[model samples]
Target: MVQHSYAVGMFPATLISLKVKPMNNQEHDEAVLHRLLFQINMEIADQTPKERELFSNSSSHFIGPPQRIAEDNIRLGLMIVLFLAGTPLNVTAMMRLRRSMLSSATPLKQLKQHLNISDLMILLIYTSSQIVWLITVDWRSNDLMCKLLKFSHALCFSVSSNVIVCIAIHRFSMVFGKSTKRVTTVSLWVAWTLAVATSLPQFAVWTVYRPYETATWQQCVSIWFVREYDIRTKNKTLLAEPLISSTAYSVYHVLIVFWIPAALLIICYLRLAMVVSKEIYCECECVKQSQSTPLTNGNMPSTDQHVTSSRRLLSRIISFSSSSSGRFEKALMRHQCVTMRRKRNAIRTCLLLIVAYIFCWLPYNAFFLWGLIDHDSYQQWHNTSIAFLRYLIVVNSVTNPFIYLPNFRSALCSSHAVQS
Candidate 1:
């Protein structure tokens, strides 16, 4: 009878010792089991065998640590520095170009009045809208703002891309006098229309998602709900489900925004390159004439000095322009160099400016394509790469004017010096 009483006392003592919180499946079952053993060891101080054995032999279960997020934060910091530094350079450069556009005379019958001050304003507004999405939009408290925020983000990216394309096309056409027809006015409308059409799908499909009924917030906004859709088994898409919104987004991006525009831009660039090269040859001729004039006499230099200097200058010019293009008309451009080189110093600065743009922006293009590749390089590259990519995108946008505006400041200063 004493043994039975003692055994009953043991049960209460063991129950009192067990004090553990609930854990995930892999956890020490640290639940009542761990607590019970601990209690037993403490209560039966003299024996102490059972609880020690359980603790010694227990399987360990630890949740993974958060290392990845920490790595990303560091990378993002570096990018922010580069991004900030380049922004003003880009704006100042674009402004220089704007000044040129406004002051420069147009030979065309119907000049584009739409381009005067509006393009810059549009670019500023679009960039500001994107900044709001990247910095402030949180769906938890504001569903409407969130949707509008995402749509604005997509709109800015698409419009900027298309607008750049329009700028490239317009610049190329004006430089070369390719089409006699007044096409710049029509092209602006077309570019905006395409931008809207491309961005519309993102607005149509994106929606705020509430994963937990009591969580008081929605999470995971984007066309890529990859994991969510991967886990989903429902055959039908619902307006209410986040997965459906994501699936539509994935399809839209894959088809409309990325693939189609990439191909079109490539063709546009090719045409532009050809036109620009031809224009360079003409500009080189102009420079050659300018160089032939002696600095003091204002009379043309002797033929021998003219020929030698012209050839050297032309080689420099062709090399500068064709190096980035990789599709230089070598055989054709080679003959032009002799006559062109005498004028080399005239446009040497201009050619170098173009080279800068190609280098800065081309790597960005490669990186952009890499983002779409289904490979581990993108996933495991650490946060550093993503941070770099983010900075690169913003930097490219801002650095463009600075790099591409050939002979911009020098030309202006030279003109002023001449006036003085």
Candidate 2:
């Protein structure tokens, strides 16, 4: 006899309908199983021990096509590469930032340091977790490990995005010549608070679920639907018991994690570009004027002793004032040059970070939103598209340290030397 029960699955879930009856021979059982497999649209199945064994033995007959296995293998390779590449890069970035902070402690540098830390979390928690996940192809760990890893996964994205937003705001302030230690401190606190609040829901949704008692395959996934018996039909049907509607959850996550931050980044960078352009234009005019100044004659005229003494006396007072004025002007120009260079470097680095963010995450979010709008699109979407987009998200974390640390190293180190 076959059991009737509901099954749950990962994202892009759909309702499943199946009919079951008692069967005597192996051929009859296989026929019924084939029909049930064709009808059920879920990844995990909940059934009795005997039926689960039967399902497991007969599963290969109609499941896990070669293309799906190849996609999984590709995803696994990508994750492993990202994990190995990102770990050392983020660690090196943090170390460099730490050294810079020791020499010259500034709020902007602190924000970047925090950004590196967020990237490290992504590498350490999320990327590595995915590597293991792809290898095992199931939840081999305990319930607590599943919850913690899932929570950390959510936390990594939330914290990294929030920190990037904070960096943009701080850079915007710097360009406008108005940055304060207090504002930076408050902004960081807010970023961390929001990240934690957004990630807390993962604990409620994700768990290690054993779909079959005698089966070793277990999944750590969201339990959005469960199987239940319908009294009228005496058949099992999937019932929704989600913490939040899937569409609503997707909307909230995408908005908080990408859309909102992207909007803010665009506004900040546009204004920043305008201000920097004007400043650079003004500098060009100053350079042209200085370069066009004519050279003075080298010859000197002979004069009498009394005339020379009178001229020399007057010249002493004039020279003193002129020297002081020249020194002050030189100091001012040097300071401005340093400030302008730093601003240009900041713009370059932030632009790279923003571009990388958009490039890496845009397709994934677009796919997610599209899937929410049209469920069939998600179901019919190519597995390669899904795997590639996911790989890109991890690539975002991997590329950040490279985008950030190299550009800032010279500037920060020089600033430190100047301060000393």
lDDT string, candidate 2, 211-311, tens digits = 44554566665544222221112222232333236445546767777789889888989988998979877876765554454222211232433476577
- TM-scores of the candidates in the order shown: 0.50, 0.72
Clashes of each: 8, 1
Candidate number of the best TM-score: 2
Q: Candidate 1: which stretches are off by over 4 Å? A: 1-83, 90-102, 105-141, 171-181, 223-262, 269-378, 382-384, 406-420
Task: Report the Cα lDDT for residue 17, model 1.
Answer: 23
Q: Which candidate wins on lDDT?
A: 2
How far in Å is the alpha carbon of 3 misplaced in model 1? 50
lDDT of 2 at 97: 85
Candidate 2 is scored at a TM of 0.72
Off by over 4 Å in 2: 1-68, 225-244, 283-334, 374-381, 407-420
Clashing pairs in 2: 6-227
Q: Write the per-residue lDDT of candidate 1 for residues 1-420, one digit (tens) a residue.
A: 000001101100111122233335432232232111111110111111212212221222221211223333443354345445544555555556556667764422122223212233323443343333233222344656645545554555455455454544555565565662456657667866876676565454445544334534343233333232322212222324543443344445433433455555566656655655676678677656544532332232334455775877755555555454333344334556753552343233233323433443344334434433432343335223433433343454554443345564586567669999
Estimate candidate 1's RMSD in Å.
Answer: 19.5
